[model samples]
Target: MTLKDRIQEALKGALKRRQSVEVSTLRLLLSEIRYAEIAQQKPADDSKVLDVITKEAKRRRESIDAFRKGNRGDLVAQEEAELAVLMSYLPKQASREEVVTAARQAIEAVGAKGQADKGKVMAQLMPQLKGKADGKEVSDVVSELLATR
Candidate 1:
């Protein structure tokens, strides 16, 4: 089955289980996927569905940070719960060590020589790490590695 199919199945399961947070999260995700499909004028493939999920997850992360900064514990908890639900659909994330190791390889492969070549290193690295790692973390790793050279 496709990723979209899996998400739909999960949504059905959540509904049956009466998992409020998960049911809502899955519904929102399906809505987002529909919007993406409308924008593209075609049904989204698995990669497109994954991109929508990733975008939604990032939004939740940002909201969680904002809520925390505002001292809104309730909002933070809600967003965290939502994020957890979204994360379940995404591929396994790369660990920090894995990110660092990939960054090193990318820097070498790109012949990146210092902070000025940060873009080059990232360009070479991100595609390999995309979906498997967070962009912010990967960028930070590349920046740190380049700075030390």
Candidate 2:
């Protein structure tokens, strides 16, 4: 099934299972998808929907960090639960080794030979890694790889 379809199925399953937390998170995700569709005046494809979901997940992670820093353990826990639900729809994250390998390949593909080529390397890598790995992590790896050359 497509990611969108999978999300809808999960929403229904959550409802049937009386999973309040999951249901709420799914509803929020669907609402975000719908809003994006409306705003863009087009239905979102699976990738677009995944982008929205990933952004929401990232927001949740940032909020969790902020809450923790502020000593709001309850809020942090809540965000963590929501993040877990959001993450269920995403593909498996790329591991550090995978990211490093990919970044090195991207640098080579783009002929990025020095620090000055950071932009070229990143431009090549971001599209390959988007939604599969965090941008910061990918950039860090790319920087490290480029620095060595």
Candidate 3:
């Protein structure tokens, strides 16, 4: 089944199990998917739905970070729970080694030298890493590679 259908199915199961975090996270994700469809003026396919889910997961991560910084442990835990739920709908994440290897290749392909070529390398790398790796992790690897160069 498509990712969107899978998410809907999971939502129903969450509701039946009375898993509030899963239920609420799924609801929010579905809403975001719908909004993206509307904004794009077209129905969302599986890729588009995954994009929406990914965006929601990123937001949860950001919220968790911000809450932790503010010393709101309760909110951090809640956002982390939501992030875990959202991540279930995404493709398997790339391993750190895989991301680093790809970053190396991308930097070389773009002739990236030092920090100056950061954007150029990113432009070449992100599409390859999209849906496979986290952006921040890939960026960190890229920066580290350049710093060593």
Candidate 4:
């Protein structure tokens, strides 16, 4: 099944299992997906749906961090729960080694030989690593690689 379909199925499963937290998170995700579809005026493919999921996951992560910083343990826990739910839809994250390898390959592919080629390297790398690796991680790896040249 597609990611969207899987999410819908999980929502139904959550409802049937009386999983309130999961149900709420899934519903919010569905609403976000619908909003994106309506805003774009086109049906979202699996890749587009994954993009929405990734965006939602990022928002939850930020909320978790903010809540922790504010000493709101309850809110932090809630956000963490929501983040866990959202993360179920994402593929397993790439390992640090994998990201480094991919970034090196991307730099080579783009002929990015020095720090000045950061943008060129990043543009080529981001799409390849999207959803699979964190942006900051990828950026750090790319920067490290570029700095050595």
Per-model CA lDDT versus the true structure: 0.92, 0.90, 0.89, 0.90
Task: Name the candidate that leads on lDDT.
Answer: 1
Say which candidate scores most in TM-score: 1
Q: Score residue 47 of candidate 3 by CA lDDT.
A: 77
Runs in model 2 lying further than 4 Å from the true structure: none
Candidate 1, superposed: residue stretches over 4 Å from native: none
Off by over 4 Å in 4: none
TM-score of each: 0.97, 0.91, 0.94, 0.93
Q: Estimate the lDDT of model 2.
A: 0.90
On residues 103-141, what C-alpha lDDT tens digit does candidate 4 reach at each position?
A: 889888999889999999999989888898778778899
In model 2, the clashing pairs are none
Candidate 4 deviation (Cα RMSD): 1.3
Candidate 3, residue 143: the lDDT equals 94
Clashes counted in candidate 1 amount to 0
Where is model 2 poorest over a 10-residue stretch in terms of lDDT?
A: 121-130
